[model samples]
Target: MNAHPLAPIPDADVDAFWRDGVICLRGLFDADWIEHMRAAVEDDLAHPGPLAREYATQAGQRFLGDIGAWAVKPGLRKYVEESPAAEIAARMLRSRKVNFLYDQLFVKEPGTAAVTPWHQDGPYWPVQGDQILSIWLALDDVTVQSSGVEYIKGSHRWGREFRPIHFGGDTEAYKMLPGETLPDIDAIRREPGSGGLEIVNWDMKAGDCLLHHSMTVHGAPGNASSTQRRRAYATRWTGDDVVYAPRNGQASITIDKPTIQPGEPIDCAVFPRLWPRPQDSSLA
Candidate 1:
């Protein structure tokens, strides 16, 4: 955590994260870091990795998404290794050590009308635990109207799982198996605070980020803004409690080789540990 460019999270911010399952740390990353990441995102979009999922011309929106950019982009790898992001995860999770999960890059071009369905991230992931969290950094200034993600506060405590929604609006997955669909988005908007549900959102500038719990119910509106493009990178992290629980029939970008059991601790060349100050702790 060498002179972590990010500011140390205050007690209030930590409290907000734990209580609300989301917290925004303003300017935690410097302009240089943001620029580096933005460049990486632009370049990656231009070249495009095998994992990149882009909308076709007929989709009527320009939404491009990719996972696991660290393996393909050097700038992303540098930010993951050097930035204060891991330390932030450690302090929030209250864990002695942390692991880099993976990278998610989502870009919403102007006038994009695709809505990211409201859902919890846990049901879709192979890893399972309460200590999962993601740091979403803004590459450009964004507002709630401009496609910033919104979270239903305290939803992480609901302790229920829902079917994962594919990016292209296929509702078949949720229809196949049943848990509970995200508490009706339209109803919540109509009757706010009716059932302990308070929707929280933020207007963010470049270098600002929202750290959200993995289980938090979140989604975003279409990029309604006519001019501004919404580019965000979400880097996930895991703590001591996280484990490999690969769900049958789901492929994870984080997992590549070897056979780690369902309940084994996650560590290796993949999911690299990032906390307790690796070199300094090794010396200690």
Candidate 2:
């Protein structure tokens, strides 16, 4: 395990988040919350739901994935929007109103070569503005060799439209433009605490959460660990001033119909407000 930084989330973290578009919050969830979430994931895996899809895998090791409203499962609904995780999100977004965007579970089996493509979460989403955020909660120990998530700091500010890619394979989908260079993951891995243009991979435990902005550039490599499985629960949220935007050529199964246009309010039934943490309240 890497030595804990052990510093309060300073203005720099929030500044980095606003400037760079991503930040990591360590040990955010307690033991009970982690266990409950773990149990929920196991139950979802065992009793495969209708939404389960063979998550576009590369080799024989297939990953089970699901989407849409998580409220169907009592455990998932309670944990996704009402847990300590939500509180952290609320504080970060600095908005009293919090909503559930969606929840996804990615469990990479040992020997899986399927790689998640580098992309921003905002474009595929049907929301507008910079109020969106995603919380990636690790349910197991994640290491660089185990296909942990990699992020390009401040890449969220990079202005580019979302591009579709074929998941799990090395094809034209993973290809970059002729002159565009992919950020060096090796250099970031080597300089752990050197600072300046650093790439961060949190040596995360079961209860750690990484809060990322909508436009942050992030992707993970193939799982190389022999026996360890990487399980994650990804919860998305939005704050005030965010609206819905419809993008052409993008398809999302979670939404029934487009209620939010490119510049409309995201007050739809799908993204219902979860917590309105009152301002000046002792809780705040």
Candidate 3:
């Protein structure tokens, strides 16, 4: 229920997501939902679940994050199930049926400086196909200088896969997934013209979100600002083409004993169906 008269997402934005692999929406989430998500994040920070990890050092201060929190937090579950995010994902992916993948929480206290390595989400997870994307919702005012998720324009269309770098900077991703790949991002950024790669990011408010493709090249800079704290939640969604492809790669650890196979459609209690909301035109 868009009770706060949010701005309608433009058709152009949907097309942009399909073509460019990333799109940002403004004022899509209402105030109450933002507050609820913020509270939920605070709860998560206090009580991180099994997959939670404080990246780097928590001794003085550091970036704290975790994934698959919908199972642990009731408010987050309600937000994921009842909010407009699923519908928005369906519209962006041009999918009639969508599946809930998982929710990732990222919080950076003021003056925390830890750069997120440039990587794509698809190769890191076991899911297959291009119908999956993540909706990153911000609960605090985010600036490029503070905490911003940047994207490489049209990187999704490149049709190339790369190794995923762990945020902790210890594990070598290329060793896990062996393959010949493009040059390192640090190398690419140094080259002249960078082979048409264009990195972009936007200053976002509490209610703003970016729906980015699974294969899109993205990474966020650390919170360098002295007084700005960044709080955000990223909800991953999948469409009809996504399946339980545990063969090609390691399926998301959040999922346990999946009942499906590589080529089969992924539909289990863990990865619940989200879209095709029942019609309710009646006024109560």
Candidate 4:
């Protein structure tokens, strides 16, 4: 698989990410990468790692999720260190450098009815910065009916943080962050102007990816399709300004705690530096 984007990312796309807190870049990963990721996804499903979790929504459909794949999966480790993802993240966030935070695999099987709750990623994590973002890559053809994610345009600039809603009715899962949580976005969508907000989403092919800021408020629907599965791999990247800020009752997947102190750049053995490729060739 190629280590760089197949085509150059236009300046306009970068601008849109800053303006809207999210943007979909088409065909950045080639077919080879998709094929490789598909195999990796299947392997992960068969042999899940430490952080894997299985969820069954009210409709009794299955939703599978796992995080920190690069720690155990060879294919994902190669993708994290060698792929163009890090550079793309750096360019989009306009950061001088980037680091690999973690990888998550989300699989909503055909007919799954679990609605990923509306929340901001920043509050759930143990990090702080404007440059943190996630690249969600589709491994299968995705449509609105097949669980495409929807983002509130420019919510990241609202200068507000929302408490995370634990998936599958586990309110006690995350320690609530200070401030009011998100309003009913689904309810708001039914009204005109969607409460003066523009929610955005896209139909994506296997190689397409959506990059969104960590503070962006977003959520996904269940896989309404009866045939196609909605499988996506998300990689979270941190830019130059981000720092390690551990929180109590962090909701994100567990990792061996880093030696890096609080308020310092998260460049420990777990969250390795990626953009300025390390001198150690084995890691790069």
Query: What is the TM-score of each predicted model, taking all chains together?
Result: 0.91, 0.80, 0.91, 0.96
Name model 3 segments beyond 4 Å from true. Answer: 1-5, 172-174, 180-182, 247-252, 278-284
Assess candidate 2 and give its TM-score to the true structure. Answer: 0.80
Residue 257 shift from truth in candidate 3, angstroms = 3.5
Worst 10 residues of 3 by lDDT: 247-256
lDDT for every model? 0.80, 0.69, 0.80, 0.87
Best by lDDT: 4
Instruction: Give the higher-lDDT candidate: 1 or 2.
Output: 1
- Positional deviation of residue 258's Cα in model 4 after best superposition, in angstroms: 1.2
Lowest summed lDDT over 10 consecutive residues: which window, candidate 2?
Answer: 1-10
2 against 3, candidate with superior lDDT: 3
Top candidate when judged by TM-score against the true structure = 4
User: lDDT tens string, model 2, 100-185?
Assistant: 77777777877777677676777666677777898888888998677789887877776754554445443463244221344444
Return the TM-score for candidate 1, rounded to 2 decimals.
0.91
lDDT of 3 at 158: 88
lDDT of 1 by residue, 1-284 (tens): 23373566788888889899998888677777887888888898798766777753445678888888787688888888888788888888878889887888899998998887788887777787889999998999999888999998998998788777777765563455446756677575776555566888998888888899998999998899999999998899999999987765454675255356779878866778877666665322
Candidate 3 per-residue C-alpha lDDT over 1-284 given as tens digits, one digit per residue, 9 for 90 to 100: 45222666678888999888998888788888998888888888888877786774546677887878788779888887888888888888888798888888898888887877788888777678789999999898998788799899899998788776677776653465744354677677778986568988898998999889998999887788899889898999999889876533343557245676778777777888878764662211
- Evaluated at residue 5, the lDDT of candidate 4 is 85
Tell how far residue 130 is off in model 1, in angstroms: 1.0
Clashing pairs in 4: none
